[model samples]
Target: MIISFIGKGGVGKTTITLNLGAALATYLSQRVLVIDGNTRAPNLSFLLELKEAVSLFDLITDPKNIVKANTEIDGLKVISSPIGSNAELDFEVLKSLLSFFNLSFNFILIDTPPSFTSETLTFMELSDYSILILNPEPLSVIEAYRALQIASRMNVKLLGIIVNKFRQDAVVSLEYIRRNFSLPILAVIPEDPMVQTYTLEQKPFSISNPSTPAGRALMELASYLTGRKIEVQLEKRGIIGTFFSLLKKLFT
Candidate 1:
């Protein structure tokens, strides 16, 4: 399936896409390919610690370069966008590339730009399914509502919303979102510090720390997408851990 992750900037779309792809590849043993569809301000490659290599733009310029453009990182295939490259994005060409990817990968997940640009629309239009990523904030929720409207008009099959960076004292509650939006709430990923730690370590938190709250949530989301049952054991947070968790909630 070709799935696209859509959301506003800094809403953790890339993080979710990378971790979910890793979870699918590591836990489910599924062949997954993640494409950096954000031609502008692309950072998925940097996050994966991918060195200089052929990128999606290379493949778009020459369709036969798919062999060299495809990179393997953390058990998932990736086609990253060249950082700081100013290449014109062609929607038709991108669509054709996705068709080629669909033949090989069990799942092709595209991380799109934040705004409603042609690039974002092209990814959404090409996707067989789309997942909205948003923070639990009023502004983010409003933007998500707008995204849903766009998806509906484009006839994009939206799987659901994944509430990222969730917290107990979030401005927008999960119940409010469920009551307002017409789609299901796929998962609620907590604000885990381990996410940042893993990022600095150049690793996916879902694969490096699958027992973290955010990690478990990502695994659950991946399981939901695959329609497969996964047994993710809850982490045992003792007294010190509970105190720190409560402290984080109190501060953030």
Candidate 2:
């Protein structure tokens, strides 16, 4: 299975994608391959502390290059951003890369660029489903919808929406997005400081602090995507929260 995480700028898409990718590995206990496909602003290397690693660019540009991606955690592999990144994505080269990499893993998650680009479009087509991450800002919502439109235009199947960095007082709530897009809001990760700490400390939140509310939420979200019966502990936030979530679900 291939899943690509795409969304708006400054919406914690990379951060969430990294942590969620880690969470997905733990949830399934399988060898998971996560690649930083966003060549423009590659933050996955920074977040995961693998800046010097050989990236996709190396794989695409070099025929003689041989590499094996290894992660600190077992059953997880990562292909960090290459030495020299390029904004213009070569669809033919990327398609070749996808075919080469697809043979090595049972599940692969790609951390994508902020907006639709030649690169994003290439990866979107390679993926089985696209996970569109968004915050609770109006512009974020609008851009996410734009991404959904792009997916439709390319005929890519979207997994659903993962609402990260969301706050209740959010200018635009999840309800607005569901009403507008009709996509499943797989999970709403409320605004939390633990996530920030994980970033500062340079550890995947799910791996460093799996019990944190946000970490648990990501795990549950992964379970939902994989069709597992994980307990829904987040139900305690309150009836009003649940009501609005339901309303948003209906609208979406």
Candidate 3:
């Protein structure tokens, strides 16, 4: 399946995509191909800990060079473009390139830009499913809904929504998110410091520390995507926290 990950700039879309790709490759033995569709800010290369070498732009531009350029990191293959490279995207060309990769890879995960740009639209058209990431804040939810509207208009199958950077204390915001969006809440990722630490180190937290709350939730989300019905669990806090968590699920 071609699953595109979308969200606002700071919503951790790339992080979630990398972790989910790692989980699928490590646990399910899937040949996952992660494509960095965000040409302006291609961070997938950095997250894969790879040098900005031959990019997807380089490979797709030359038809005679039919060979796919990718690097295997952890257990998945990644196709990324160098950051700040002004390689414009042609939808037809991109569609052909994705079609080529789709035949060989089990899953194609495209990490897209936040806006409704040409690049993002191309991926949406090519994707079989989309996973929207959002925070518990009102503006984030509003932006997510706008993305959802675009995805629906483009006829992309939305798998679900992932609420990232979830704070246990934000009861009102959480309640608003639950009440507003119509798609299934795939997973609620906690605000964990390890996520930032791993990002700075350019590592996948699910692979490095699966025991952490955010790590475990991401793994469960991976399972859910792979046809398994895994339940998402929150961190165990005190009685007041438990009450709020129960309230968070009322709109589910």
Model 1 residue 138 CA deviation (Å) reads 1.2
Candidate 2 stretches with Cα past 4 Å from truth are 61-67, 229-252
lDDT for 240 (candidate 1) = 59
Candidate 3 per-residue lDDT, tens place, 73-133, comes to 5458767777787778887888887887788778889899878788888888888888899
lDDT of 1 at 46: 66
**Colliding residue pairs in candidate 1:** none
lDDT of 2 by residue, 48-154 (tens): 76524767766777733324566676667777775456646678887777777677666788888777777778888988888888888878888988898888988
**lDDT of every model, 2 decimals:** 0.83, 0.75, 0.77
lDDT of 1 by residue, 91-183 (tens): 777778889878978999899988988889989999999999999998898999999999999999999899999999999999999999999
lDDT of 2: 0.75
- Candidate 3: misplaced stretches above 4 Å? 62-74, 228-252
Stretches of model 1 off by over 4 angstroms after superposition: 69-75, 231-252
